[model samples]
Target: MDINYLLIHHDELLTYLREHDYAETYVNRYKTTIKQITDNASNHNWTTYEDVYQWYVDQSYSPTYLHEVRAIIGKLEQFHLHGNFPDNKKSYSSFWKIKSAYTKLSSEYKQLYEDFETQTCKGLKSSTVASYRTKISSFLYELQCKGATSLSDVTEKDVLTCFFADGVRKRSGSLCANIIRFFKILSESGNEEATRILAYIPNLRIARKNIDYLTDGEAAKIRQVLEDSNYSLSCKDRAVGRLLLHTGLRGIDIACMQLEFIDWNNDRIRIVQQKTSQPLEIPLLPVVGNAIYDYCINERPMSASPYLFLDSRAPHNNLTTDGIGYSVKKIMSAANIRQEKGRRKGTHIFRHHLAIKLLSNGVPQPVITRTMGHTAPESLSSYLHADMKHLRECALSVEDFPMAKEVFQSCLK
Candidate 1:
């Protein structure tokens, strides 16, 4: 459809959105985006939606804003061609196209995945189910490539080759775990073939990588920058930074955090974690509490989103994990952290710093685990590698194998 046509019927589109239960705020935001894109199209003498879309992509909007623009523009094109666009929430499963391997699979192999998904995923969260579906589809595809036609046709060598294939070892633990779960479910349903295949899945040793975290000096710089009032940070930015620094909340958890999660009267913040679906309650440190209040009272947009943090513009939807990561980068830039090339600068670094700080202060691993809302106690072991204070205590004396004084002098030089 042409830009002129969209511009002419933009009002009709907005009305249609409202009729489809889109929030009024979202409708209004769509109207604004439509006008903006159309105006740009007119100035550039661009007639088609594709022309406007290409132009929009070249602009310097933030990642979050760009996503909103892309979604609105795509919806407009869909509405102009058809009478309506697909409801995103209802189209979740179709969003991830099943791999070609599954497409080529004989009916028997395909049934294995379908049965596992339909029967085994009954009580699992949608995200977990989606993950399992992807893993199983990929594994089954590998089995097909290895010349297996059916479950009964598979051998231990086929299973081992699939498990140890290139780029699979890093996640061998999770991939194997999910695959095993699928087989166990099938076995319980009396698939004897599945029980035999289960015996072929090998246990994998997960290799832990060194974690990068903010040093005390770098963390102090972040604190100073946030408090300086010289960086012109939005209250929401400050609030998110403080939450990550003080509360050690995951970016996804922070993104999904709701207004009601806070207990102002008791100075505690409660949440059901997104990763593990477990409940966690943490103290609302005064720094975090004040920033949140400032954002909500003074800076937050006028919207009815139950989420605590939101997009600044109309519709004001909950902030995404990407949005939270962007905020962390912004705060780190203001503090002059991680500007060096190849340095890691994700929000999880703050999480790691918090855990290591807790460990350095002599907090028990169980206490730290609960505070971090880790799904398993072993999850905290990675941070132990970053806890330099206690690690030093475990160091052995070098007196027994001391080098010559001349060698030490040469090393020092």
Candidate 2:
């Protein structure tokens, strides 16, 4: 467990990383960081994780730099334990972390929350379950802060205070509605206090908003970046961008895409939709097909993962949802699109753009619904707001209500 012992194998580690295809620049960085740690250890004595943690804290460096240092130390630990670097993976316990408030709750309240978790998660998808767990934790944390130690101690006033604690306009109506449903479930289970709390929570009405999509000019610029070979985008980045632009696949779905999903002979791409758990199949256009082929054959990292895309780093794994979104953001920056302050630049914009384009082209609603893998046809209605061509056709003539053109002649003059 001695940190100094690990430092002795540093040369071997660098050689191993190099053999595994780590970038030369990154290898040089690792060399410098390890040298600093080694030199500091020689001046003083440090051998354990605690010593390394204190050393990290004493250094006057930004949080980002400290995090990088921590990653290096983690790599060293992996080398020492496994005799080689393993794939990037989070610890098992990281997935089960509970909020400090949950730990401090009374046994009864803790049981209540645990029961809510178990009951609510049944037959739910992983993503939906994760979301519900987070909102429930936030709700419980606020309730505990407001001094409600148990269900019996919870008052209507405490409910309102905790609900509004997230701030007025920002208060999550879905969260409150979820809490109401939780209490209604408990009431059916013969808990009178849960029944009383139900009357305090009100139904929240959510309003629909216009979807954000790329304008014609912005779309043209993105297309130029994807189409032009002279652009500085990597093969992987180009592949991801083209998939979003041409297929309208959700970022998560694209991140989870497998190599076998592409039916090259049939010219189609197929996968189960992540959000809705439904199967979707779409034609593989030449542009998207070519880009993917370029990345897979020439640029993709050597990995045993069945995923179509892998990270550029060693122990390359499937790209994550955030990673896919970041690729889109980077492409946008390169294209000089959405550079204005507070402009939306996420991958979902490409989805909206695709929907609007199809709608404008008079593509049937059922076709758009199937292409986007929407569970219901009604989901396609939102993009109609951005379908400017269709909106124009609905406009009526103002000639009937006009007083006279001559009445405005003086103002025109």
Highest TM-score against the true fold, candidate: 2
What is the clash count for each candidate, in the order shown?
0, 0
lDDT of each: 0.81, 0.80
Off by over 4 Å in 2: 1-15, 24-51, 77-101, 165-170, 187-190, 202-210, 395-413
What is the C-alpha lDDT profile of model 2 across 174-246, one tens digit per residue?
7767777777777888888989888887676656655557898998999999889888888988999999999
Residue-wise C-alpha lDDT for candidate 1, range 260-327, written one tens digit per residue? 99999999999999987889999998989999999999998877779999877444678888889888
- Candidate 2 lowest-lDDT run of ten: 88-97
Where does candidate 1 stray beyond 4 Å?
Answer: 1-11, 14-73, 77-105, 114-123, 145-147, 155-157, 160-173, 184-192, 195-205, 400-413
The 10 consecutive residues of candidate 1 with the worst lDDT sum are 88-97
